[model samples]
Target: MSPNLLLADESTGSKLRRNLLAVAGTLLLMTTYTVLVITQPTDLTGGLGQGVALATFAAYLLSALLLLAAVLRDLPVSTLTLIPVALGLNILLGQFVGSVMVPLYLDSIGTVLVGFLAGRRAGAATGVLGTLIWSLFAPTVLPFAAGAALIGFLAGTAARFGAVRRVYLAPIAGLVSGVLVGTISAPVAAFVFGGTSGVGTGAVVAAFRSMGDSLLSAVTKQALISDPGDKAIVFLIAAMLVYALPSRMYQSYEFVRRYRVLGNLSGERD
Candidate 1:
């Protein structure tokens, strides 16, 4: 075998190892999070049992599988990374912070990020699959999944037209996608899981009423007081930091290529 072929094999092996390690780390993080969330001490905490927990595990497994498939198929790493991060963070936030404002917002951000990076077809596929997995825990997430797929398709198309690559444009895309997905999800969640009764027909009307009341209350409360907790603020900062790192690394990689940095550093004789 030629030296070039040997180098290619070595690089491929390294990447495979990195990808496998990333997946393993993600699984460990998610599993730890799920156990903590489902075994919380309060009755009102809505802890899922073994069956649901297993399902949640399966969801992450599916997400990993999807990401691995994307890698094998030569999709961009930006697109694939979103799945593991989203799954891990969603569980973490839900466990530590509860499924209140932050978790929902983060979920929106994740979906939008995936949609932005992957383009419409892949984005839609990932969004639908990811959302379906999430639905195992919260069935009301279905509409959000559907809406995300639509938004992703639009965003992907816009990206092709150069409307999504700009930094200024990204937040706009994210906001629009968030609003569309969130609106549909909010109603469905309210309708499906808002009531005190069991998850069925008799609870539907009460669920809707309660959800309307909560929405009104949230608006009023937000207008009156803004009390963001330290934990939430910290988590937000951390998330931003984490998201920015990948882009920065990608830029560094580009710079290295442009300057032939890696080529020159290697001391191999011709």
Candidate 2:
């Protein structure tokens, strides 16, 4: 093989290796936290699971760092620049909707957009980073960092499946994604926060709780109701925003080129 071909093969191999390690680390950490959260000791003040929770937090932070480092290795500088902008979009809209006590968490719009444009790693990184930043002010968001990363990962998966090719299909994908996300996040919400994550979501949970639903069941019911519509709206908005941008700008992304993420409007890569 030519030197160029050899180099390309080496680069691809390295990327694959990094991603696999990151995925494994993230999964391990996710499982650890999920298990701990679910089986939290009832006597925290007297220090039953406090040490374990602290250790888990450290492990979680380390895993996040590893994932971020691996995913960022191959991203172009231009794509990296968009992360902050996307994060801003996530925080502003999410915070506003949350502050107003809206049941929908439209926080992942930017995460979904990044995932659709840059592929899964970048998308996951964006979600993770945005969640960490949000946690600075909203401590409650800290535990859901994995959920945000999942949203970004799913957005990229949806784009890979051509969900973005048709405007309507994007929202449909989002709705389906919501079901999976909601189910995964329900355990955390129920056990950790006692089903009181957001004002609107809490109200729904309360309604279910009042109806004699178990804690987990009430939270899961509320998540099923809120997450699907929230994600659908987010997907539709991201799709519109993508199409609204100048084709030249979006077409330049390597992901858009490789995946034909923009469909016929993808244009030719320079």
Best by TM-score: 2
- Candidate 1 lDDT over 81-131, as tens digits, reads 655664555456545554454422334334433444455555555556666
lDDT of 2 by residue, 38-106 (tens): 775444334654565455555555666677777876777777998999999998887888899865779
Q: By TM-score, how accurate is candidate 2?
A: 0.81
For each candidate in turn, the TM-score is: 0.39, 0.81
Judged by lDDT against the true structure, how good is candidate 2? 0.79
Model 2 worst lDDT run, 10 consecutive residues? 40-49
Highest lDDT against the true fold, candidate = 2
The C-alpha stretches of model 1 lying farther than 4 A from their native spots are 1-82, 93-104, 154-166, 182-243, 246-270
Estimate every model's Cα lDDT from 0 to 1: 0.42, 0.79
